[model samples]
Every structure is written in C-alpha cells, then in structure tokens.
Target: MRRYCLAAFLLLVLAAPAHAQAPAASLPKVAVFDFELFDTSLQGETDGPRTDEHDRLLRAGDQIRKGLAESGRYAIVDIAPVNAAAHEKNLQACGGCDVQLAQQLGADLAVTGVVQKVSNLILNMNIYMRNARTGHIVASMSADLRGNTDESWTRTASWLLRNRLLAPDFGRPQ
Candidate 1:
C-alpha cells in the first residue's frame, strides 16, 4: 500500500508542472475605434480643429490598440474593414453605435476614446471599453495632460494604458 501511494504522489507532481506550462486560453476579441476630439476651448471655437488634430486622433487610437495587443489582454479585431462606415457618424455622440459596429465585426467588446481639449494648455484623454452584447461599460480610464504637443499626448496615452487602464485592479468600481 505504501509503495502504491508513493508512486501516485510522484506522478501527480510530474503532471502538475506540465499543466502549469500549458498555453493560456485565448483572450476576448475587441474592436478599438479611433479617438475623437472634443474641443471646448476658445481657439477650437474660432479656428475649428487644429490642422494636425486629425493626425493626433489617429495616433491616440493606435497607441491604445498597440498597448492592449502587446500586453496580451485582448485579441484586437481590425477596424479597417469598417473604418469608413464608422466615420459616417460620430461614435461619441451615436449612443452605443460603437457597440453595434463592434458586434458586426464579431467582437466581444468595443473600445473607444476621446481627447477633450480645454485649451492648448489643458486637455484630458479618456478611453472606454463596453460589452458588445450588453452595451454596458466594462472599464474606463482617463488622464489629464498639460500640453498639446505630440510628446505629451503620446506619453499620457501610454501612461494611462500601462498604469490605469491595464492595471490589475482596473474596471473594478471603488
């Protein structure tokens, strides 16, 4: 009986390591949309959007997509197929239109963000993730930026993803 018990214990121990090393289950797919700008400052009011604002918006969306993909947190569904269709309306104002589009792309969640400019000197960047089926927000994060320069915008986006949005405790209500 003792010999039999010892043999079983050894086999269990050997199998445990293999199980632990198995590849992780695939992550949920998400559709990440382009970031939009909401300009509230007087300059934005008078001059319309800055000439380079469109470029900035594209970069912001790319940053979030790259961060999420590199972190292995989500399987990003390519938005290129539906990018033009999405641009037909503003996702920010469409009231869950983003979720519907994500569903059409076979995604489980939809991601969106906006950069709100109070002035050239003050801005806030925010990102939101919503369940495609439920259309409920799953997680969101924001960061305040002091400069409108490219470096500031890029760094803030990265920081928000690395420290807040992607943090282990993120998405849990306080």
Candidate 2:
C-alpha cells in the first residue's frame, strides 16, 4: 500500500505544470513621435511665428517619451528613424504617418501628440496611441491647459500620463 501511494504521488508531481517558474513576458515596444504644434495665436494677423512656443511643444514630446518609458509597461523605441522617414516622405500632414514610422522602427505600438494653442492662456494637448500593425487607435487622451508657463506644460503631460495612459483601467474596450 505504501509503495502504491508513493508511486501515485510521484506521478501527480511529474504531470503538474510549472507555470510559476516561467519568465515574465517582454513589454511591447512603443515609438513616440514629437508633438506637432499648431499655433493659432497669429491667425488672421501679421505677427511672425512664435518660435518659443514651438520649442516648448518639442520639449513636451520628450517628457511624454520619458514618462512612458519609466512606466515599465512599454519599451520606448528611439524616434530618429521616425523623424527621418517623416522628412523623407513629407509625412508631417499624413494621417497614418505615425503608424508608418512605428512600423519602420520595429515597434508594436505608436504614439502621437498634438499641441494646439489659441493664445498664451488657452491651449490643449492631445495624445493618441495606435497599433502599428493594424493602424487602429488603441487609446486617446487629452488635457486642457490654462497657463503658458513651463510648469503648466510639464504638469499637463504628467497628468495625462497618470490619469490616462498609466491608469489601471486604461485601454480597455467599452
């Protein structure tokens, strides 16, 4: 009886699956493009372009990239290839440009942002995440900013990340 019981226990142990020791799956790679600036402050006016606002939008893009990378849910792919492809293809206005760029970088996902400013006191930031393979938007988030200072821009980016992108229930289909 002892021998039979021991044999049964050994058989069960050998047949059991070993899922606990399995390695964690790799995070998906995401390519984040620079935020495009559309400043309407001088609309219907003769004022020159606001280079300072343009530069600030560019900095916002970098902050977004850094935040996503630090989240550990995604691997941030470098944007050099994306920039090169955008310039070569004149994809600045193309709707699917971001998806194309992400595919070129071998990324699984793509992120694009837009900063639209009507004046120094009123602005909006929009961010979109898309599937590189299917070209479908997986998630979209935006924040309305009231101030024109550097602190306001940085805070908006962080708020978007915390409240939308990195949220526990983010990207779920309704």
Q: If scored against the real structure, what TM-score would every candidate get?
A: 0.82, 0.77
Question: What is the per-residue lDDT of model 2 for residues 116-153, given as tens digits with 9 covering 90 to 100?
Answer: 78877899999888888888888999899997788888
Write down the TM-score for model 1.
0.82
> RMSD of candidate 1 to the true fold?
7.2
Which residue pairs come into collision in candidate 2? none
**Which one is best on lDDT?**
1
Alpha carbon lDDT at 18, candidate 2: 69
> Whole-model lDDT for model 2 versus the true structure?
0.78
Q: After aligning candidate 2 to the native by TM-score, how far in Å is the CA of 46 from where it should be?
A: 3.2
Question: How many clashes (backbone N, Cα, C below 3 Å) per candidate?
Answer: 0, 0
lDDT of 1 by residue, 47-161 (tens): 9977688898899899988998787667789998889988887887898999999999988888899999999999999999888889889888888999899999999989988
Q: Give lDDT: candidate 2, residue 173.
A: 25
lDDT of the candidates, in the order given = 0.85, 0.78
